[model samples]
Target: MSNLTTLLALADSRLPTGGHVHSGGIEEAVTSGLVVDLASLRAFLVRRIRTTGLVCASLAVAVHRGALSASAGESGDLETDARTPSPAARQASRAQGRGLVRLGRRIWSDEDWDALGPTPHLAVAAGVVGRAGRLADQHTALSVVYTTMTGSATAAQRLLALDPGDVAALTFDLSALCEQTAAEAAKDVTDLSDPLLDVLAQRHVERDRPLFAS
Candidate 1:
């Protein structure tokens, strides 16, 4: 496959990485009435991208660059755990991380995923897999950030019955921002926090019938 196709496939929602089960807190945001319309959704997306998205991008770049590694024991998993104040968010991340490792082992055969430990962060998995595939660090970061934005938007679509076209268009419009954020984050993974998202994640996990894991 072509280099572009390879990257695209890695970022594809159909890749079976278990991304569909988590909404990046969108379901909880909607249930709490914090995101009701396109305007509010966009606002929430912006906040998320600036905070959680940036951190994920940084982690992806670090793993891809080998600055952090499962084998080296500097996986940055603890940092992600610390940044993610919510236990539910951490669990969701590890679940996705495990899924990525499973898929990566099948695709790349030689990579030592076990070094990353029993459960690395999702962005860390992306970095490891992306590096093994010889993908660019910026692109790896972009993929991570893009998923953060798109996953929530797709969840909102399902929960609110919003216009799919409009939701997709919104994602398209945010592409440039995602790119910029990824670029900056690749330069340095800034430590940031989003208390509201943490609160929502905690609340979502406590729900009797939560739609998304976090």
Candidate 2:
């Protein structure tokens, strides 16, 4: 497949990576009344994209650029853990990572799959997949950042019965910010943290009947 096609396939929400089930803390945000309408949702997404999103994209870029590996010690996974303060968020990331690793191993041949262990962080897995797919660092970063935004936005749409058109427009309007974040992420690894997201992730785990995993 072409490079663009490969990137699209990896970024597709229907990739069976278990990404659809996780809201990236949006469910908890909604329950907590932090995000109610389109305006609030946009604010939430902007904060997310600037913080965890940048961190994820940067880690993926580091892996894709050969600056980091998926190994346990001194690897991208540890960095991911350090950047992610909540245990629930870490678990969710590993769950998605396992799915990505499973799919990636079936589709691509790479020794990094074995090195990634049974449960790598999502960003580390994404980087390995990007490298194996021969994708550019920028493409990899963009893919990570895009998914980071879309996953939560999708969950909010479902939870609030939001107009799909408005949701689509909201994401489209933020495309430039996503691109800018991805560009910066591709340049270096980041340790940005979002305490509210971390708290929300933990709270989501405690919800009696949560819609999303995290």
RMSD of each: 1.3, 1.0
Tens-digit per-residue lDDT, 117-160, candidate 1? 87788978988888988888888888889888888998999999
| Model 1 stretches with alpha carbons more than 4 Å out | none
Give the best candidate by lDDT: 2
Clashing pairs in 1: none
Instruction: Mark the 10 consecutive residues where model 2 has the least summed lDDT.
Output: 66-75
lDDT of each: 0.85, 0.91
Model 2 pairs in collision: 25-214
* TM-score versus the correct structure, for each prediction: 0.96, 0.97
Report the lDDT tens digits of candidate 2 across residue range 47-80.
9999989999999999888788777655798889
